[model samples]
Target: MPDRLAPLTEALLAAARKAGAEAADAMAIDGRSVSVDVRGGALEQADRSEGTEIGLRVLIGRRQACVSASDISARTMAEMAERAVAMAREAPEDATIGLAEPADLARAWDLALLDLADPAPEPGAAELQDDARRAEAAALAVSGISQCQAASASYSRQRVFIAATNGFAGGYSRTSRSTSAVAIAGEGLAMERDWAAESRTYQSDLPSAEEIGRLAGERAAERLGARKPKTGAYPVVFDERIASGLVGHLLAAINGSAIVRGSSWLRDAMGAQVLPRGLSIYENPHRPRISSSRPFDAEGLPTAPRDIVRDGTLKSWTLDLGTARKLGLKSTGSAARGASSPPAPSISNIALTQGDHSRAQLIEAMGTGLVVTSMIGAAINPTTGDYSRGASGFWVENGRISHPVNECTLAGNLRDMLMRITPANDARGHLSHVVPSLLVEGLTLAGA
Candidate 1:
């Protein structure tokens, strides 16, 4: 920790070029965390947090601002670089802001093949309350659960750092580990809750605690006695533990700041044909132990591997570097930010592109419909790619499934529901999207 983010981004770019700013950028963070919670047999909460933060942005030509702190003295980084160079001298010019062009930054790569930090030794807090009391006693020893309510365990570490005045600077460090459980089932008002979690970056690829309390007591005893189905159009499926939220609504309708604010709906779909002609999605920021692997970006650029849907067209647009200079297009390094704003267009480690049936053969090739599996809220319109939400699970019929239903809703339109997806072949691959278990077909729902 004797780096202090390259001397707090070299004293926040010498206090934004001594406050008259012309260009600037800096970011810093150093974090730490630990959590543990459990219920019914001890410790219901425990937390620990550590800190260090700093941010600055400045600019002035093509105006810019942004400021942040956790007081990294030197008079709070010289009053956060003179209040971000007097708020970028009254901000508001924006010819797509600036920074990032020393031949598009990111000079040199490979952070040990991005295994992203996890050289062990961190756990504690009584080893996260004994991994949340052995994941709430393996979800109350299964058999129609009835309680395990909240069990958790966590750990974290950060360390970021960016820096720029166009010359760029870098930094990295990461670590994580988690475990969760929720369970619950029949009783008053006929209960029924469910949950299960896992996260890793080694903890030897976390997973136990009785495999997250027996998968949260077999998913709350498979939603004990639910019911609702019956209300118009059909075919749904979805569930590969929430099919990467339908490719996260086509990656927020191909964000490039929502296609330069025309409010995306695939913003007139670039190369058109969106999904289902052969699927595809790609992305990949250097995988290795994943967790949205990253090498540069956040304005230091260099994050390779692309294809935002190929074979099915609609490729690219998740830019960054001021939305690729406001759409004159290019910087698909897909920036990202924190420590308080600046740098947008996110997305990292995608995958999708796997299908050879098998989600019970797409539920016997959808001989009936709806399979969902938890979802709620979200209406979504984002410029008319419509879509609704709510949902629950189990209902198939002619091809298996059958019981458990609940609430309902569903609706459709995400460009004709991802042009009638299909996907399946399990997906997971250390997530950060990696979609699968899709199916689709018609939609509408509503219910009972």
Candidate 2:
């Protein structure tokens, strides 16, 4: 921990104690990031940023309050602490709100979470510009690729530290690298554009510039001369990348805040069948190659693999300390935190169990249906499970992909969709939610 930050934490803790606080904690984060963008084979924009912030939390009797600041001076820390205590004093008391007891802290897991010594790569401006230019140029060289909208690369590094009055202190750091390219195909009145993006925990995992460009070009070229399909109900196939978004939606509905506020459709549905048989979903904080892996959760709760849904049945709801206390249930160790905010429930590396059928079998099983490649715009109602989203993809005919479809909307209730899930073996683990290509029996698609 940085000496400057440690003193700030100490000051906040001291202020809380002086104000008669029962518990207190502070968290700080320092991070830096850079981005580069290229268009028409030219560097268009480049930027870099660095930031640091601290957050303080205090508990007075049964009330709790929190405050945050970018200023880390002793005076600022004391003022933030006083603000937290005063706010706690003014707020209505809640019987279940308090910090985790020292005894509740988990034995430290010797995970290599922080790579502090990893040398930050000095990716030169010329190198970034060249990378983006080469990617865009490669996309333009591909057959059937007529134009490139944009290409870019980004690198970022972040460090975080947490200190609590209950003798819990820890910090970790990670780095990320990403590359992406977008291309448009066809000409005149029929133009289609698509993009491909790749990210990894370390810079070494990034795909070569040529590979990324080729993928983007191929995706766009395939969408050339797209047409709209007839409106009807049919089986739908979701690509792994897009399917992960659906999983994220479901996870949001199962968060502790949603459950406690009665805003989630899954509320009170634990231990009940929520999806089709043979379907399962779980959060694995220890999963390798995932950016969100952690030994402990944001609230200092020990994290372990937990099944959220098993064999079509709801198993548990994600919980933070407050929600767990309120519900009289043990904390699920799913807490997540931002730089200057109280901890909230969040799943890490959600994985959906794959089935026996292969990708070919799954696609073949869809005799005549929409093969959704992308979902555009948000149209999910978490509280009601109602969903409608703009979609784009190719049409499957006679168990084979025919041509791309455009200007379509897929509408369905998530509850009904879950019940109709039939998983395939094409599960991909690149994203946080590793799900297979899913086949839903029937969905309403509106198209011209």
Task: Report the Cα lDDT for residue 45, model 2.
Answer: 95
- Per-residue alpha-carbon lDDT of candidate 2 for residues 303-365, written as tens digits (9 for 90 to 100): 888899999898989998889987889889888887566788888878888889875687798
| Per-candidate TM-score against the hidden true structure | 0.38, 0.94
TM-score of 1: 0.38
Model 2 spans > 4 angstroms off = 1-7, 113-122
Using TM-score as the measure, which candidate wins?
A: 2
Decoy 2 TM-score against native = 0.94
Which residue pairs show backbone clashes in model 2? none
Clashes of 2: 0
* Cα-based lDDT for every prediction: 0.86, 0.82
Model 2, residue 216: what's the lDDT? 92
lDDT of 1 by residue, 196-261 (tens): 998988789888888888888898898899988999999998888898987888898888888888
